[model samples]
Target: MKKFPMTVGGEKALREELDDLKTVQRPTVIASIAEAREHGDLKENAEYHAAREQQGFIEGRIQELEGKLGSAQVIDVTQIPHTGKVIFGTTVDLINMDTEDTVCYQIVGDDEANIKGGKISISSPIARALIGKEEGDVAVVQTPGGGVEYEIDQVRHI
Candidate 1:
């Protein structure tokens, strides 16, 4: 499988989740399944069915996390040399040319992209346009609504 880029923090978060699922959730589900099995009737038991469903979901998630963790290339923003150019895991300050409104966004991995947290996916239109561009450069992004232009004000590796 191809390796995916992930920020150091994002990779750590996934690792923590994987650990929790393996140590806590897996045991809890196993215990629940065993308890449900003790209720006797296997075919018509609603509790048993629910426990089995929960087990399936937990197992699936564990496997997914494991796969992602195995193939993730974790990039630490702090370790990157401070360059004015925009790059992955760099926080960028931008000003919308039309509205004159300033917005800050950190380019991050797909799994860690959260607009509310000021993180944009690396594959996003804005990030793609901003990549390798230095401060004071304009990035023209094609949004769903319309074309938007943003002027890069600063780039910080944080």
Candidate 2:
């Protein structure tokens, strides 16, 4: 089985979702299905069909979460010694060589990546280029337009 690397926060979020699905959603959907069953025949009952569909979705999500949680390798970046080199779960500050603009991004797992939140996926082109690079080193990221160079200004465990 492939191990899923994730931050502590990411693991916690998935666990929370799993808990909600099992404790709240599963029971609620069961109740809905039972109530819909009393209303009419199975073939023409819209409410019963809708409830069953919702139940399928909830069950599927629960299984997916469980599988992810089972294989998750949670990495708490704060516990690692800082070495000024970009690594998984490290926050990196970079200066664009061509535009002179700066950007800060936290290297995170695929499920936890959010560009608006300054988190980039570990498998992304830019993050892949930045990995193993130290402060003051320039990383060239290949993009569709062309290669873009970013100078690593800082690498933080926090």
Candidate 3:
């Protein structure tokens, strides 16, 4: 099985979701199903059907979370030795060569990637180009639009 990389915070969030699913959602759905079944008339039981669908969804999420946790390779960014390179879990400040716009992004696991949160997936084109690049280095990223250049201003491991 291929292991998925995850930051400590990402892993914690996933674990918390799993715990909530197992402890709360699973039991709540089970109880709902039981209550629905008590209404009788299995042929025309909308509540029972809805509860069953919800149960399926909850169980599927639980399994997915468990699998992710099992195959996760959690990395603690703070514990890793930093040499100013833009590796995973490290935030990098970049200046767009064309637009001259400065932006900061943290390369993180796929699950933790949120552009609005200043996080990008490690597999993203920009992050791939930024990897192994130190401060003051130029990274050329190949995007669908065209090739874009960015100058690395700073690398922070947080």
Badly placed stretches (over 4 Å) of model 1 are none
> What does candidate 1's lDDT look like per residue over 38-117, in tens digits?
99999999998998999999999999998898899999989988979998999999999999999999999999999999
**Candidate 2: where are CA atoms >4 Å away?**
none
For model 3, residues 24-91, the per-residue Cα lDDT tens digits are 98999999999998999977999999999999999999888998899999989899888998888999
Judge candidate 3 at residue 115 and give its lDDT: 97
| TM-score per candidate | 0.96, 0.96, 0.96
Candidate 2 lands at a TM-score of 0.96
Candidate 2 minimal-lDDT segment of 10 residues: 63-72
Candidate 2's error at 101, in angstroms? 1.3
Model 2's number of clashes is: 0
Candidate 3: residue 8 Cα off by (Å): 0.5
Would you give me the overall lDDT of model 3? Answer: 0.93
* Model 1 pairs whose backbones collide: none
